[model samples]
Target chain A: MSTSQAPLIPAPGDTRRRPLVVMRSVSKMFSSGTLALSDMSLTVEGGEFVSLLGPSGCGKSTALRIIAGLGDVSTGTIDWPSSRINSKGLPEGDISFVFQEPTLMPWQTVFGNVYLPLKLRGVSKSAAREEIMNTLATVGLADFADAYPRELSGGMKMRVSIARALVTKPKLLLMDEPFAALDEITRQKLNDDVLRLWRETGITVIFVTHSVFESAYLSNRIVVMKARPGRVHADFPLKTSMSRDAHYRTSEDYRQACEKVSNMLIDAIGGEEH
Target chain B: MSDHASAFVPPKTGFFARNRDTLLRTLIPICVVIFLVLLWQFIITVNSIPQYILPGPLAVANSLYNDWGTLSPALWVTTQITMQALALALIGGVGIAIFLVQSKWIETAFYPITVILQVTPIVAIAPLILIYAPTTQVALLICAFLVAFFPILSNMVQGLKSVDHNLLNLYDLYGASRWQTLLYLKLPSSLPYFMTGLRIGGGLALIAAVVAEFAAGSAGAGSGLAFRLLESQYRLNIPRLFAALVLLSLLGVVIFAITSFISWFFLHRWHESSLKREN
Candidate 1:
């Protein structure tokens, strides 16, 4: 938790690496009069494993949706490092969203589900077969390529979903509490698998989760949000080596990092404006 | 290779156990049918009912055999009308459903007309239709079409609307065109609903055909089963009337079976409705 070194929010010259995107005072107000988000700002660098940690009604999903261009922000500007991609990452070059549920087509086979994003882009299924299969192997679901979503266990279904997200090979991947519905064992296992996947693909992941342990474990950076017109409460960077594995999970440092993030979560839920 | 041969051995399955489930499923319905027929025969004989009032099962069977020559042509006519109406309904209904789902304005404007056609009793409209149409066959087809179209339309609409929002967003995120979404997502999603509608419409189509025939029987020399039914009724040919009714009911059963087979053929692999479960 404390290496006695750099601050959580790095300075502009932190590593001579520019953020992939920057959101300054982003806010969202629903038509139903629910101000879901308010003046929340964040900066995500490419290939970083980031988690948006928050409670149930804290608009964590809303933030992720806004990023994926599925929902619009009411105020504030989301700027990309380059103007090639739109503010919401539209025209669909470099973004994939994973919903809280698997969001797979029930009728589609595992291969079919993974092939969806590519298929939508007018790529023939035959042409996309290799990439889809390789992505399936990355998620450890190669054998289930022909299996339907309903035939799969919850974990397997989520694996297929992750494969679909990765099939597109987007620069940024957005996940919204994807493992919240899973059991503890499956979730922990998936956490490890996801980290492996991130390392292998070098895709930036902005995962939203309410679990402090999950956020601490999976992310290099954690952005904490609070409810009641959702806004950023804290943004902390964890000191984790890129090679962290099963051994790192049981270490005192990981426990301390979880403890620190857990306290910030309590503050967010308690309505303390830290 | 034989070091772990146990894993490769096929799991043992008992002959009776495997077939028992299917046997029971098939057997129970057949037994119930036999029991009902026997009970019907028992009641009729016990009440000393005459053949004119209520024919026994044997009498009906005989009537079926004796009247087969006279009845087969009428059966063919009825079958033709039922099939033509069903084909027309399938086309019109599915086409309208596709049209309805294309835009909210179009759906909102024309959906009520479909509802009106569905709710109005086909029997009441049959006479009016007969008066307007050039021939009785066209009127009969229209009646059946009106009766059968709504289920397909409504179910298809529900199917199209039932597409998961996440899947839709995924399509959008990929910049898939609207037509692409419909082709790959919406149409397949609606298949189960369309099948359900087809099954319901199948029986309704037959009923509508028969009902329209009854209405049109007096207007012309309509040789459909309903005309035979009416003629037998007037001449007091009770056995022939029973034979016609039996043929009509059997046609309904056949239509039901065909539609169900169609549904099972399409959905058995993926859909829960048609999946086989372990006992």
Candidate 2:
């Protein structure tokens, strides 16, 4: 189940070029005393797309929540180098989240959903209209600003969720299997769209998914996790340097990378059962 | 090949069939009302029932037109009492709902009393209320409010409590204040339920007002339609009694229609209830 040891903690005094997020010796124990994560640690570098790949009950989502500050670490600390840029000692707001469900406000229009983070910051719609439109355009939903979520297809709704996440122009984006519920075709299409957006904006992405092929296709590094007090079991660097496109799917290198991740996942699961 | 060709052909529907579908879907209830009226007219005419005992529809209509001089003023008084009671209920019920949501202890102490009011028969309490209250109008208003207030309070409380846990967490993450959460999330989420309670409460309040008037006889120098009904019945002026009953039913229908329309107007854009009807 284990691979070569990769130091989860970032080197101290190298904070200037260190990963944007650093989680060290983190653990989460629920009120029921179930240990979801035990001494789990990970560092996500700037402008990198990393996938937390694991089976069910692997606490991958919990790890992402700890990074997002949505969940508290019971034992250790999470350090964000980006927070040093803010001088007021206030917690920074340079992170966004996209959940598994679209989670759009049912009462709000698409445009209203995208404008929510800005609105929360007391930014007027008139002041941020250009940026809102530009964000919607990037998601190819410029014409759907007035549409309600009920009127949208599953894929379209996920697109709106992505647009809302990106509208704030955050440096870090945390997504929890945002396309897991969509059809395979739609999921693949969204995967391409998200990678394109990532490349263009240089925003660091921490995506959680159980799909080996998806991890290989979309991530620079796949952080493989094992269950039952979940912790990192492998950190595999995907070596397919081919540009992510339709041709990449047909390349021999893509299949080999996917196969490698799949074998690691099987071994991790097999070890857990014993 | 022949079967496949036939599969794509559309069937032709007759004019009557199309029209019948429309009428069955839309106008059948209206037709039933007309049919019932005609049947009632036939029964009264053929039975040779005396006008004082059983007035024909035409006779009641004539009496209603002739007595408009008196009937209109009584209608105005009833309408005023009903509206004032409803308005008071709206303000008090919503204020109480807000209090209840803020403090669980207040809800625990007061919610049972609201349930008692809802389940207790209004007819049993009206006379006691009338005897104790300073004025008959006040007594009637109190009765109406008693009947009307609980629905709005109960509905709004449920609505406020039904807010999504995730949404609340999102607000917390954004550092939104309690007031902001209530204003932006709780209030908007509760509107459809509140409106539903109002519509139901409006009709119930009218019934309470009329019944209270019936039980109290007449208040002050001004009498409402209930008094006229009593006056007609005692004198055996059956046509006029029938006329008053018809007017009362019409008033009930109008109140229900207007409240429903207002609910629809506000909620038509986002709510499923209105959307289902539109489709």
Pairs with steric clashes in candidate 2:
none
TM-score of each model, in listed order? 0.89, 0.86
Query: For each candidate, what's the DockQ?
Result: 0.57, 0.36
> Highest lDDT: which candidate?
1
In model 1 chain B, the worst 10-residue window by lDDT is B214-223
Q: How much is the lDDT of residue A40 in candidate 1?
A: 88
Report backbone clashes per prediction.
0, 0
Across all models, the iRMS values in order are 1.1, 1.7
- Candidate 2 Cα deviation (angstroms), residue A93: 2.5
